[model samples]
Target: MKPSRLARDAIVLRRAPFSETSQVVDLLTPDDGRLSVLARGSYRDKSTFGGPLDVLTRGVADVQRRKRSELDLLHGFKITQPWRGLRRELTTWLAASHALELVRAFAWPRDREPALFDALAGVLELLDRARERYEIEAYLTSFAGRVLAIAGFVPVLDACVRCGGDVADAKRGWLSLAQGGLLCGSCSTPDRTAIVCSDGVVRLLRRALGGAPDATPGTAWTETVVSEARRAIDLYVEYRLERPLLSRRLLDRAERSPSREPVA
Candidate 1:
C-alpha cells in the first residue's frame, strides 16, 4: 500500500541541522499553523524536495504526520514563491526576516490561524515591492502592531485601562503594561512602566487594532507616527514576550547609520 502522506503550502520559517545529512525545518502554514518537520537524508544523492528549503521561501510541502508530541516528517518541499526581491536590499531582507521571527514567536506549534499566514504574506509582498527604507519600515511596524492585535494581547486604547475613563478626546495617552491599556492624565503614575503616545499615534494604533488593511500600498503614515508606533510596539512586544527580537535590534543599528554599508 502507498504510504499515507499530506501536502501543505507553507513558508520556511527556520531550519537547523539534524544529523549531518538531515535537517529540521520550522514552517508556517495557513491551515496547520506552525510545524516542525524532520527532513531525513535530504543531502543524499537522490532527494525528493522540489528545491532547496531556504528560509522565507514559500512552497508546497509533502509531510507525514505522527504523534502530536513528535516532529512531523517532511517528505518534500517544492518552492512556489521564492520572494527573491527580499534579498536584493538590506531593509527588505531584514523586514521579511523580522516578520518570520514574529510569526514564529506568536504562532503555536500545529495550531491553525489562517489570518496569521495571510498577514505575513501581505507584509512580505509589501517589503519585496517597496524600495524606500521609510516605506519598508512602515510596513514592518504595521505588521508588528497587527501581529500583537491579532493575537489579542494588545492593551486597550479607547479608555484609560485603569479607571475606564474615556481617552478618545485626549491629545495623547500613556500605555501602561500594568494597566493593560492607555491611561488618562489622572491615572498616569510616574513610577509605572508605560509608553507615551500622541493622539496621532493613538489614531494609528486604533486603526492597527482592527487589522492592518490600511497597510496597503496606497495608504500612508508620516515618518514620525510610524517611528513612534514602531518604538511603542517593539517595547510592548519585548516586555510581553520576555525577550528582545534579535532581528529588530540589527535593523535598528543598520537604519541609524546613513553611511554604514548594509551587510546583507
Candidate 2:
C-alpha cells in the first residue's frame, strides 16, 4: 500500500541540489514541525515546483512519508509569501538566513511547535520591511529570545539566575551563559563565564524577551545597547545550542566589511 498524503503550511528552511534534477528540502510547519522532503525534478525547467525554492519561502507542501524511511516525498508546493523584500537587501537576507538557520537547528522534526512557526513567520515579515541594520538586529535579537523561550531555555533577565536576586535594583549585571540568566554583581565571580552588562542592556534584554515583536519602544536603542544586547543574546543562544551557528559567523563577517552599513 502507498503512504498516505499529508498537506501542511510550511516554510522552506533549507534546500540543496540532490542529483542532477532533484533537490532535498527542509521545511518547518506548524502542524508537522520540521520535515525533510525530496523534491523530484525540482531543478528542471518544466518542474512542478515553479519559481525558486529558496530559503524562507512560506508555502503549502503536499508530501508523503515513506513507510520505513525518514524522508518524505514532496508532491507539490504552492508559495504563499515569497518574501521578495528580503532579496532586495543584503542585510535583510542575512537576517532572514540567520533566523532560518536557528529554526532548522533548534526545531525538532515531527514535533509540533506552532508557536515557533508563528514567530518565524512574523520575524520574516518584519525582516522584509526593516529599513535599517539596527532594526534588523533588534528583530533578530527579539526572534532569538522568542525561540529560546519556546524551547524552554529562556534566559533569566529580571533576576540573578544564581541567587534569584532582582537585577533591576542593581547597578550592573553579569550575563551567565551557563547559569542561563542575568547575575547580580554580588552573585558573580571571576571564575564564571559571564559578560558584564549595564543596567540599560539588562532593560533592553528584558523588553526583547517580554515585548511584542511589532511594538515600537518608547526609547531608541543606543549603539552600546545594540552591541551589548546582541552579544549577550548570541552567547546565551550558542551556549544553549552547544555550538555556534554558521549564519552568525557570516553575519559577523559581513558586518566587519568596510562597505557594510554602520550598525551603530
Candidate 3:
C-alpha cells in the first residue's frame, strides 16, 4: 500500500534539533492548522532540507504522518519566503516570533484557517520590511484579535455581556477571560471579575473588533492609544491562549531602550 502523503504551504513556527542530524518542526499550514513534522537527516545532508526549515520561513512541505510523535520525515520542501531580511533585525525577528507563537497556540492539526494563515504570512512579510515599531505593534494586536475571532474567542467589545447595554456610554467594564468578554458597569460588580477595562480602552478594543491589520491609532495623537491597545490585546490573548508568547516577551525586551523604561 502507498503511504499517506500530505502537501501544503507551511510556515515554520518552532524548530529544534531532534537528534544529531534531524529536527522537529512545528508548522502552521493553510490546509493543516498546526502540525509537527520531522525533517529527517536535515542537519546531516544540508542539501534536501537545506535551511528553509528555519523559524519564520514560508514554504511548501511534503510530510508523512507517523504513529510516533518525535519527528516526521520530510519528503520535499521549497522555500518561498526566507524572510532573511527579518533575521537581521532583532525587533522584526521578535515580532515575527510572537505571531508564530500565537499560531502555534490557537491552531491545531488539520484545522484549516486560510485567512489566519494568510494574515500570519502577511505579518511576517511586513516584519521582513518593517521600519517602525508601531507598525509591528498594530499588526500584531489586530492579527491577535482576528485569530481569536477565527478560533471563536471573539470578545464582546461592543455591548455589555450581561445586560446587553450599549458599550458606547459605559465608563468602565470588566473582561472575563473565562466568560470570554466584557461585563458592563452593572454586571461587573456582581461577577467580581479579575480584569477590568476602561470605556476608552474598550472603545479602542472595539475598533480592533473589525480586524483591520493595518489600522493603528491616528497620528494626530500620541502612541498612548496604540500602547494601551497592545497591552489589552496581549492580556486578552494570554487569558485565552495556552501561555504567554515568547516572541511577545522578546519583542518587549528588544523595544526597551537603555535610556527608557518599558512601556506598559
Model 1: lDDT of residue 172:
88
Report every candidate's CA lDDT: 0.80, 0.81, 0.72
* TM agreement with the true structure for every prediction: 0.91, 0.90, 0.84
The residue ranges of model 2 lying beyond 4 angstroms of the native Cα positions read: 1-3, 214-219, 258-264
lDDT accuracy of residue 201 in candidate 3: 59
Query: Which segments of model 3 are wrong by more than 4 Å?
Result: 1-3, 66-71, 171-173, 189-200, 217-222, 258-264
Candidate 2 lDDT tens digits, 3-46: 46977899999998999899899999998799899999988898
* Residues 141-170, model 3: lDDT tens digits: 677777777777778776766778766777
Q: Evaluated with TM-score, which candidate comes out highest?
A: 1
Rank all candidate structures by their TM-score, best first, as comma-separated numbers. 1, 2, 3
Error of 1 at 151 (Å): 1.4
Instruction: Report RMSD for candidate 1.
Output: 2.6
